[model samples]
Target: MNRFLVLPLALPMVALAAEPAGQATTPLAGSDMAGQLGQLLLGLLLVIGLIFLLAWLLRRVQQLAPRGGQVIKLLASQSLGPRDRLVLVQVGNEQILLGLSAGRITPLHVLKEPVHLADAEPATPEFAQRLMELLGKDQKDKS
Candidate 1:
């Protein structure tokens, strides 16, 4: 078993060593501007792909983030008492309560809002659709 494993691994190294010692190891033969530019473009493409992937993942995480008033209510009740200090934030139509106590902080509940999500600047469906389009364009460009 040891010989079988060792032989396979050793064979590649043996084959690599068989190449002439003085031969150059540059990826493409003939040093030219276009080849270097092509390599640079490939590297740039890889970086852009990684950035898009991260943005896509971030959007997914944001989409999956918790919503509704109940979760806020539970957190608030668990983390705050009657005398605790609290900050209420209202964005568009959503409200979040932040509780502050001596050496501790917690979320209290989501307050009722006068405004609704429908009035927000960027609607969820549009944002998701645009994100998908951008990702699709990126994939098409890659191909």
Candidate 2:
């Protein structure tokens, strides 16, 4: 009676432990690695996105931060020709007009009374303005 009951319980255990014939009992290692490849790419993209976000935030903060101890501030500017321009700069309480060309800068005059101008965007730098003008001229020539 003990032998009969033991065989019945042991038979099911043996069958459960046995793998089906002519088939893999475990998954391929390459397939497992391939599945993780997607996760790796996603993580890489997330890190790159985080870097870009931080860079953008840094730029924004720099724009909003106070610029202290600036000795000279550009108050006004006007282009004389292509390469020459007049720049008015504030140093302490005095405003001086300066002449800027390709190779040199000259102090033209020192104002007795400081000229006050409205708060506005400073004049675009020379290189950018010249580039745009050149591009515009090319287009005009083509037309």
Candidate 3:
């Protein structure tokens, strides 16, 4: 059994030792390596670019779907805890305040009179404008 096992393993080594020494060992040429690397990098970049393009197209397609005709509209939502929230939802003309917990949603209040929201300028400015105003204020204060 020992002889049988040793013969099988040693036969391949004997065959390798008997091969001619003049044969080149390198599988790929030096000049071809750079071209192969460039092709590989280009292929990787193409796959990544295709992924980004698909994501952008999916977002645009989602935005194109009709969104104005929904029956239930979420007016506002405020988080009370990690898993609890207060949500104001408008179903048709009636607005309802809901207390949302982990397990269940309970109706807190129902507004009998709908409050009219005027189309005046927004109460808060845009984030960039607000940041610029704050920085200006800070600079003025320092001076």
Candidate 4:
């Protein structure tokens, strides 16, 4: 009984081993280590090529259309609290209330002087330039 059971298991293994030695030693195309290595390298190169292509496309698109105001709200919302600086100037009976924050501040306009608040424009080129210069100076100072 034991011999019969052992024969069934051993016979298959013996038959497997009886195949030609050359056939057993031969490697399949898929199993070739160098082929696998080359395939892996090719896949990596393909990924890198795709990344460079995307970058080139993005650069071309950017060149074709120059865009601005991508993050105006982000920049405008940086200051959490009251973003505007309020200045109260009392000249005689009348009181001048001025708000200076972000795009409101200027270089030439004397914030120290107590002037009338009736004459004030929200959008001024001179004001914007002065504000830009002031912001640049502030950034430089911080850095």
Candidate 5:
């Protein structure tokens, strides 16, 4: 009776140990490892490509959106001092000149007739150009 009980348990253990001699027990073969690595790289590249595609689409959509017909338009701005500015803004048909200091905005004037602005050319020079002209005038005066 002892011999019969031991044989029953030993038979299952022997079967579990008996693996086929031709097959490998480990699953990581060279081809399998290469294929898995390829799949991982492809997935990473797809996620990166999708992010760039979404960003490009967002930029295109923003460009297509309407930008005209705004109520307030900045016609021109000039730096009055280090921390002060004079701004000309057009609100609908009325043109307003505003003085902007460090902490306050004062309305300087409102034009009864809107200034006729040329379509292609601006009346005022750029800040950099104006600054260069002032510097040149100062050098000439010193000479």
Candidate 6:
């Protein structure tokens, strides 16, 4: 068994060593190495691009997830600690105060009269508007 395995492996090495003296190694060895390196880099770039595509698809899928209905609306949230928060929620005519911590949500109280917070600014500006604002600031700063 050992001889059979040894012979099979040795035969290839022996054949490789038996090349004719007149036929030296190919002169395009360097070019072959460069081609192989380029092929490797292209494969790496393709894999990275595929990963980014998958990540973008995942974000879009999550954003498009169905929310059922707007039965419950969050009024406001205040962070008490790093992992704890007080959340005010409204459902129909009822308002609830809830305490939220890691892995648990506890109802703190039920408001007889609903507490409404002051409304914040309207919807945020898109990328173009934000970019124009930044450019205007830069121009003003340079003046």
Per-residue CA lDDT of model 2 for 25-105, tens digit only, reads 456757878879989999999999999999999989988977877888888889999999999999999999999999999
| Candidate 2 lDDT score at position 108 | 94
Per-residue C-alpha lDDT of model 3 across residues 28-128, encoded as one tens digit per residue: 56757799999999999999999999999998998999978899877777799999999888899999999999999999999999755544543345699
lDDT of each: 0.67, 0.87, 0.85, 0.61, 0.87, 0.86
RMSD of 2: 10.9
With candidate 5 superimposed using the best TM-score fit, by how many Å does residue 90's alpha carbon deviate from the native? Answer: 0.6
Write one digit per residue (lDDT tens) for candidate 4, span 1-143: 99999999999898878886657577674568788899999999999999999999998998888454333211111233577554443444444454467777532232355443334432223576889989999999999
TM-score of each model, paired residue for residue: 0.31, 0.50, 0.57, 0.32, 0.49, 0.55
Residue 23 miss distance in model 3 (angstroms): 6.7
Candidate 3 residue pairs in clash (backbone atoms < 3 Å): none
Candidate 3 Cα misplacement greater than 4 A, ranges: 1-28, 118-143
**RMSD of each candidate relative to the true structure:** 14.5, 10.9, 6.7, 13.2, 9.8, 6.0
Candidate 1 lDDT, 1-143, residue by residue in tens: 89999998999998788775535556445666688989999999999999999999998998887765433222112324666666554654567776778787676776674323443333224577889989999999999
Ranking by TM-score: 3, 6, 2, 5, 4, 1
Backbone clashes in model 6, listed as residue pairs: none
State the lDDT of candidate 5 residue by residue for 41-74, as single tens digits.
9999999999999999998998898879578888
Total colliding residue pairs, candidate 2: 0
Clashes of each: 2, 0, 0, 0, 0, 0
Residue 17 of model 4 has an lDDT of 81
Which of the two, 3 or 5, has more TM-score? 3
Best-matching candidate per TM-score: 3
1 against 4, candidate with superior lDDT: 1
